[model samples]
Target: MTHASCEPARITEPDLIAIRDDLASREPIFHRPEWGSTRADFERMIAEGFWETGASGRRYSRAFVLDELERRYASPPLDDDWESCDFHCQRLAADIYLLTYSLRQGARETRRSTIWQRAGSDWKIVFHQGTIVQDA
Candidate 1:
């Protein structure tokens, strides 16, 4: 029998704080609807909005993220969950911002966050995470 090893993905305190700041607010920090539809939409969002997932202990390189995205595209199409998403954003610095949101699909609900940094005239994501909310 072979045991597969898995590493827990972790994000830094500052990044966590940035994400939390967005979540703490009742109002959305920013709004962009075009980046929330299909895999291609999200890929465009990732490419144009984030540099990378600046998260530690996870395989979140640009190639990795792209590959993962491609894999998702290979699967059956998902519902347009973003249409019902509750989103929020917070600025961590002059060009650094955190976006957080919750989405519901079928019977499952998930909370997600991403950190973005502005480079030149574009914004790039440096970190991302999604957590499923379970019923009590």
Candidate 2:
């Protein structure tokens, strides 16, 4: 009988931090809803290899991110002002971290958290979870 070899797992906390930094760096670029403002930015993100999953459990690569951004831009405005954003590494182990970010814009604010693991030296994102919180 033939069997398939298992792929080794290589995830870490420092990796998660790097990914967070990379994503956070893009906030300013993504905040711009105009296609002209974001097209090249989104393309660059894809070239750099950022990826995420959708509610349907389908893997969304950097190309998908750009496509979705375009789709959103085609629709009515969906709030694009962020007064501030904060990130905290709640839990860390080797190359994994439970990260939380609180974002605020004018009178509205929300907090989002995610579990990130390193994929390699590049630090690919693994998971994300978010929630809204009342302003303190």
List per-prediction Cα lDDT, in the order shown: 0.53, 0.53
Residue-level lDDT tens digits of model 1 in 1-136: 3343452233436645655453434211122333343556556446443434222324365667666666765765454433235455567788777676665555666666777766576455566766667422
TM-score of each: 0.50, 0.44
Which tens-of-lDDT digit does each residue in 1-136 have in candidate 2? 3344463232335635655665555343356443244556456433344565433446666666777777776766576667546655544677665556666766656665555555465333445434445544
lDDT of predicted model 1: 0.53
List candidate 2 segments past 4 Å from native: 1-67, 73-79
